[model samples]
Target: MFYHLLFPLSEHYALFNVFKYITFRSAYATVTALLISFIFGGWVIRKLEQMQIGETIDTDGPQHHQKKSGTPTMGGVLVLTAIVIPTLLWADLSNRMVLLALLGTVWMGVIGFIDDYLKVVKKRPKGMIGRFKLVGQVSYGLILGSILYFGGNGDFVAHTSVPFLKDVFINWGWFYIPLVILVVTGTSNAVNLADGLDGLAIGLSSLAFAGYAVIAYLTGHAVFADYLNLLNLPEAGELTVYCAAVVGAGIGFLWFNAHPARIFMGDTGSLALGGALGTVAILVKKEFLLVVIGGMFVAEALSVMAQVTWFKRTGGKRLFRMAPLHHHFELTGWSETQVVVRFWIIGVLLLLLGMSSIKLQ
Candidate 1:
């Protein structure tokens, strides 16, 4: 909004010229989101508490976590607010990339909110049937894919740039829609699985989005794109503001979400954030890098899949001390903080490795 309202006045007033720069807008967006989270974190937690929307710990999981059964959940509302308000205020609302990213975030957020509401408020142990959640995710992918594919010029190709290979792309042809659906749905669930530990998911998400903010800027700049041998996406620079908002929101939420968390993001945050990141990757044509950027999340999701597959294959034999990878370490006598910090170190390494792609190519 500020960009639309103030930037136009740049001709009349030089101060407003700063709004024309994505870097300037992105920096302020980050600060704005951080402030919003700090300002509203307590109130949102209190409101959730007042509504009696506490988390119900799983009995079969970590015995020690049982103590957190009543901690306020659904803090994603604060995260969502921080992200949306900052982007709207700082980003050019007229940008299609910004609008599409917001739609993806809000869409998955609503699905998550429904699930949390069912489990916490409606007293349904099983919140949002699996198929329904899949439907919601698939629907967003379909909409996004259709827009990007059909909305572009006749020469538009449904392809993704391969990492570490200059001018190389995997053209999915018409199958790009399915690819989008897969990326959106898979990423959202992966982040959700990583939410097992305090500050784990949010911390990793913050790092991932921080890296993406840089990537968005590079992809949008023709000079940077040419230097890096990346596809130049006009107007995609606006996504930097959105990605920065996510980073700031995650960091702000982390202040309260650190060990002995004051509130859990629940499905609401995990899904929306994951979806937003995926949407950014799609818009920037860096879908493949998501694997490296979110490597820890992928491991968390894969651990569960592997554990389940092993359990069924071996006639109930267990795989890992527990699933999601984090709990396995916890059950193996690693302290909660150890697991979180180590995972963060690994996430950081992966982030750097992913960022190296900009030059390594």
Candidate 2:
């Protein structure tokens, strides 16, 4: 869109030179998304409230959450809206990664929207069944994985670029297809589970964008890549712009999604964000490192599964007071805000650790 039409003219117009810098455009993108979310978030929340699209707290799960029953649902729309607009205006529309990212935003968004609609409109207690959601995620993984494998685009073994590896490049074997499917699907579900708290998921997800964006930039710049002994991916640099858009969008979404949440992102945001992260990782050729960068999400998701499995296996029904770890603190007398903020702090720490991997490796 504006990126292409205005970029060529950048050479002729001195002011347009700002468009050449991903950092500059990223700043604008971040501000644009933040403004959009801050301005429109209230209206969207009001509309949802009027429509009676509210949260349905699991009564058996947590007692205090019942008060959140009337909170507006489907807040993920705000994030998607803010992200798409600025990305279109500021990002290179010709980039394959950007196009795939846009497609991922729309595709997973619709899937989430359908689930939210079923719960909010149709009044289905279960909304979408677990199996159906899994199917959707798996289907997405299949599409993305196959595209990466057969599109002839991913044939470049130079794809696996781990920072500080000192010339050690790892390529995926033939089993990489199933491995990729597992990566994308698992990653999406991991983020989906982490989205249970206000600002928690989005905040942690932002850290990933920060890490991957730098990786994208390094990979794209031959000088940087060679100097650092990392893989030099020619077209992958555009991922920096995509990563910037994601960071901007997350901050914007967090504006209204803070503790006393004006709106809840629901599955719509979690799935879409997760899918977006996975797509960027694949494109940037750092699919494996995502495990370390997004470790918090994995830990949160695993907590739930571990608790459930333990409870079912033992008639004693023993586990954390609640799953997701955050709720466990809630049951232990921490306020919602307390749990949310502490989780955010933990996320910040983990983010630093993940970032350290770049230099430590």
Candidate 3:
């Protein structure tokens, strides 16, 4: 909004020209989102409290977490508000990539909101049948893939770059649609699985977005893209503002969501944030890079899968002390904070490794 209204006046006023810079707009977007989260954090928590929307803790989980059973959930509303408002205000509204990314975020957010509403308000333990949730994710992937395949007028390609290999690209052709479905659904569920600990999922997600923010900026810059042998995505630079907003929103939410949390983000935040990140990676043609950027989420999700597979194959024999990796650490005498901070450290290391791949080629 500011770009559309104020940037035009750069012709008459020199200061207005600053709005044309993605870096400047992205900086403001980050600050704006952080402010929005801080200002509205308490109010949103109060509303959730008033509505009696609280979390339900499982008896089998860590005993220390039982105390958080009633903390207000659905804090993702605050995160989405912070991210969307800033993106709309700071990004180029006409940009198709921005619009698609916003659509993915909001769509997954709505799915998560419904799940949270069912679990918290309606008292449904399972919350929005598993099939329905999968359907929603797959449906979103179909829409996004269709748009990317058909909307760009030959600008968009089904070829994705391979990290650490110069001039190496894989063309998925028509199979890219299924790949998109898998990426979107897998990432959304991965983050949801990792949200068991306070400040864990959001913290790692923020770092992932920070990495993508740099990738988006570089991909959109023709000189940098060419120099690095990356895909030159003309509209991707605007997504830097979106990524910054995600980072800012995550940090602001972490202020209240840290251990001894005042509120929980529930599925709303996890799904929306994960979907947004996946969409951004697809738009920037760095889909495979998400494995490295979101390494924690992938590990968490894989732990669950491994545990389940092992349990079934071995006639109920357990793999880890618990699934999701963090709980295993917790059961092994690591404090909750220890697990979270250590996971965050690993996430940062993976982020740096992923970024290095951008240049290693």
Candidate 4:
């Protein structure tokens, strides 16, 4: 809104010309989202409390988590609000990439909201059934993939850029749709699985978005993209504003989501954030880069899968003390804060490594 309303006045005023820069708009978007989150966070928490929406702890989990059973949850509403408002105000609404990113965020957010509602309000311990959740994810993936493949009207739409290899692209041909479906669904679940610890998932997510914000900016600039030998995606530059919003919203939510959290994001925030990241990666032709940028999420998801597979294969033997690498560390005597901080350190390192690939290629 601000972009459309104020940018046109650049012809009459020199200062308004600043609005034409993605960097300028992105910076303001970040600050706007941060302020929104800080200002409205308490009010939203109070509303959730008034509605009796609270967290449901698993009895089989770590002993310390039982105390957090009643903390107000579904705080993702605040996050989504902060992100969407800033993006709408600062981003170019006419950009197709921006519209798709917003759609992915909102669509995944609704799915997560419904699941949280079932768990907290309807008292369904399992929340939405696994199959139903998978269906929702798959459906979104199919729609997104179809749009990118058939509606993109570009040569790179059906191809993905490979990391560490300059000028290399892989054409998935007809398999692109299923690949997208897998990436979207897999990423959404990975973030969900990593949400066991306070601030862990969101903190890492913020870093990932920060890195991608740079990538988006570079990919959108023809000169930079050519110099870096990256896939030039003109429309993707607008995603920098969206990514900035995510970073700010994540940090704002972290204010209350940290250790001894005042509120939980539940599945609502996790799934939406994951979906948003995945969609952005696809838009920028950096799908493989996500594996490195979001390494912690992938590790957490892999741990759960490995644990389950081993348990089933061994017919009784356990793999880790628990599933999700964080819990395993907790069971091994690491304090909760230690696990979260160490994981954050790892996430940061991975983000740097991922960023370096952009130049290395």
Candidate 5:
């Protein structure tokens, strides 16, 4: 909105031209989201408190987590709100990819909100069952698959881009549908698993968004995309505004979500963020690189699956002291803060490595 109003007058006022630049607008979006998060953090937390919404830590997990029993949850809603509001205010709404990403954000957030509500308000022991969450995720995947398949506006499945290879666009044709499902489902759950600690998941998500902002900008630029041998996505530059919004929102949420967090993201934040992450990657044709950039999420999710699968395969045996990787550290005497920070460091490193792939070729 501001872009439309201000950028046109760029010729008349030198200051107005800043709105025409993706970089400048992205920075503005980031700052706007950060301010929204800080200003409204208390209100959101207060509402959660009034509603008595709290996380129900499983009895099988770390003993220390029990102390966090009554903390507010579903804080991801605030983060999403901050991001969406800023993006809408600063982004070019006519961009189809941006619209789709916004839709993905709201859709996943609604599903997650319902799950959190069931757990927090209705007091279900496990929150919405695993089957329900899986169904929601699969449904989201199908929605995206259809959009990529039949949404003529975005009708270009030329091939998936590989980061550091020459002539390496991997086309999937009909197989792309299954790949879409896998990407959506895998990313949603991976981030979900990584949300074990207060600020871990959101922090990593912030870093990933920062990297993706640059990727989107580069892919949308013909010269840069050509130089890096990346997929040239024409309308992708606007996505940087949304990515910056997320980066800002994450930082804002971290103000309250950090160690001894006042609230948790719960499924509301994690699932939605994961979906948003995957959707952006798909738009940028960087779906394959997600595994590298979001390595923390993958490691966390894998730890849980491996632990459960190995336990069932053997008699009363397990893989880690706990699952989700971070819990295992907690069980091994590392403080929750330590695990979160160390994982954050890993997230930052992975993001750099992922970024390097574009130039590594």
Candidate 6:
């Protein structure tokens, strides 16, 4: 909004020219989102408390979590607010990539909001039916995939850039849509599963978004993309602002969401953030690198899958003490803080490794 409103005045005012820079806009987007989250975090938490929108901890989990059963949840509303408002304010609204990313985030957020509403507000144990949630995710993925496939120009369509390999791209033809759906849905659920501990998911998410912000900027810049041997999508630069908003919102949310959390983000945050990240990665042609960048989330999702598969195969046996890798560490005598910080350390390592690919190629 600011870009559209002020950049035109650059002809008249020299300062207005600053709005033309994606870096400048992205930096301000981060600041704007941080300020929004900080200013509204307390009010939102209080409102959730007043409305009794508290969490319902599962009895099967760690005993320590039981004490958090009534903490204000669905704070993803604040996160979404922080992300969307800043993106709209700082990003080029006409950019297709930015619009698509925001659409995906808000779409998943709505689905998550419904699930949280049912589970927490209505006291429904099952929340959103599994199939319904999956349907929502799949539908959004289909929409996004179709748009990217149909609207893409020339060689960029239906192809993905391979990391750690110079100028390597795989043309998926019609299969690109399926990959998009899979990535979007899989990432959305993975982040949802990883949201078990306070500050865990958001902490890792901020790191992931920070990494992607750089990737988006580089990918969209012709000179950098050529120098780095990266796939250049000129319009993608605007996504940096959106990614920065997520990073800022994640950090701001962490202020209250750290250990001994005052609030929980619930599915609203997890699913939306995951989906948004997936969308940005796809837009920037960093789909494969997303796995490297968000390896913690991948491992967390895989642990649950492995646990379920092993339990079914062995009739009552288990793989980990608990599903989701973090809970396993928690059950192994690691404090909640220990597990969170260790995972964050691992996340940082993965981020650096992923960043190295930008140059290693």
Candidate 3, residue 263: how far the Cα is off, in Å: 0.6
Instruction: TM-score each candidate.
Output: 0.98, 0.93, 0.98, 0.99, 0.96, 0.99
lDDT of 1 by residue, 1-361 (tens): 9998999899999999999999999999999999999988988889888988999999989999999998999999889999999999999998999999999999999999999999999989889999999999999999999998899951354878888887788878888989999999999999999998899999999999999999999989999988988788877899999999999999999999999999999999999999998998889988999999899999999999999999999999988989989999999999999999999999999999999987876
Q: Residue 103 CA error for candidate 2 (Å)?
A: 1.8
175-227: candidate 4 lDDT, tens digit per residue:
89998898889998999999999999899999999999999999999999999
Worst lDDT 10-window in candidate 6:
152-161
Give the winner by TM-score: 1 or 2: 1
Query: lDDT of all the models against the reference?
Result: 0.92, 0.79, 0.93, 0.93, 0.87, 0.94
Q: Order of candidates by lDDT, top first?
A: 6, 3, 4, 1, 5, 2
| Inter-residue clash pairs, candidate 6 | none
Task: Output the worst ten-in-a-row residue range by lDDT, candidate 4.
Answer: 152-161
Candidate 2 lDDT tens digits, 149-266: 7776455632465644655566665555766667777777788878777788898888888888888888788998777665677777877777777788888778888877778998
Clashes in model 5: which pairs?
none
- Per-residue lDDT, model 5, residue 19, is 85
How would you encode candidate 3's per-residue C-alpha lDDT over 205-244 as one tens digit per residue? 9999999999999999999999988878889999999999
Candidate 2 clashing pairs, residues 3+ apart or interchain:
none
lDDT over C-alpha atoms for residue 75 of model 3: 97
Candidate 3 residue runs with Cα over 4 Å from true position: 153-156
Error of 3 at 265 (Å): 0.4
What lDDT does candidate 5 reach at residue 122? 90
* Per-residue lDDT of candidate 5, residues 1-361 (tens digit): 8988878898988988888788988999999999999999999999989978877888877877899898999898898899899999999888988988898788888888888888888988777888988888888888888877777543367378777776677778777777887887899788888888889999999999899999999989899999988778878999999999999999999999998899898888888898999989888888989999999998998898899899999977988888879988888888888999999999999999999999975
What are the runs in model 6 whose C-alpha is more than 4 Å off? none
